[model samples]
Target: MAVLPLRICGDPVLHSPATEVSDFDDDLASLVQDMYETMAAAPGVGLAGPQVGVAKRLFVYDWTDDADVRHRGAAINPTLWIAPVPAGDADPETESEGCLSFPGERFPLRRSPRAILQAVDAAGESFEVRADGWLARIFQHEYDHLDGLLYVDRLTDGHARTAAKVERKRGWGVPGLTWLPGVDHLED
Candidate 1:
């Protein structure tokens, strides 16, 4: 396994919609392994292929609290469906989130207290998962990467302002000012 370099927020590849994996072969397996290594090295809960400069619908995540334990797995060609029932505050409180792509920035993100997702694994096996709290939020956040969306995009103005303030406090440049490679001029 190898640790791949994470593409920063200004990398254009992050904006490109990832292509679906057509074959589950050795290459895909290797990619998943590499992604796991990269995520572990970054010490992040979740990672997507686009963040590593790969335009494939792939992501790996493990939300367990034990940092010493390496429990990581890949999701390929994943799809999400919001739960029918409204989430209640009894589940868990919102937590501040930081992204690998957006260094030195953090923002509060509201996520479903619980969620159910259907996805395939690296072996082409189908699985249904029900997760709550931090794990659920991690799954949803990584899944959005496959769709060419970032967590910041879902933030409201207040959240965005908070993120910018966090970056400034950390002595980093203003968040969202950098032009991600493929997305630079498209917003004009």
Candidate 2:
């Protein structure tokens, strides 16, 4: 498996909606394995297909909750059903989120505290997941990638302005942005 090149925020593939996975074959299985390896190399809790320039509706996640239990999962053609964050479920303050696509930047964004996701596995088997707390936030973040959205895009006006300023300083928001797994500079 290879740790594929990550597409940056301005990459067209990152902005375009992904195509659904129709064939659950050896090729698809290989892509999933590669995605898992890439996510691990990124050291990110979650990653989506478009982040790796695959333009497919898939994502892989391996995250630990506050209780120290590890939860690992992969979703293909996922449909997320998010639940409203109740008055008591979480602290009212915004939560911080980072992405492999954005690399060294982390931003605070509002997300539901719970969600129910229905998706299929690499073998085309169906499954449902109900996640809450930080895990739910991870799911929502990755789900947004399938629709060409970054967590920063969900920020409020003030937060978005701050994020945009940082993005400009970082030399982002250009066409054809690409980077190696560990390299900060854009690739040719």
Q: State the C-alpha lDDT per candidate.
A: 0.72, 0.84
lDDT of 2 by residue, 106-168 (tens): 766667889998999999999999988888998999999999998877777666898798778
Q: Which ten residues in a row have the lowest lDDT in candidate 1?
A: 179-188
TM-score of each: 0.77, 0.90
Misplaced by over 4 Å in model 1 are 65-71, 84-93, 162-188
Per-residue CA lDDT of model 1 for 104-163, tens digit only, reads: 456766777677777799999988777766777788888888887777766777777776
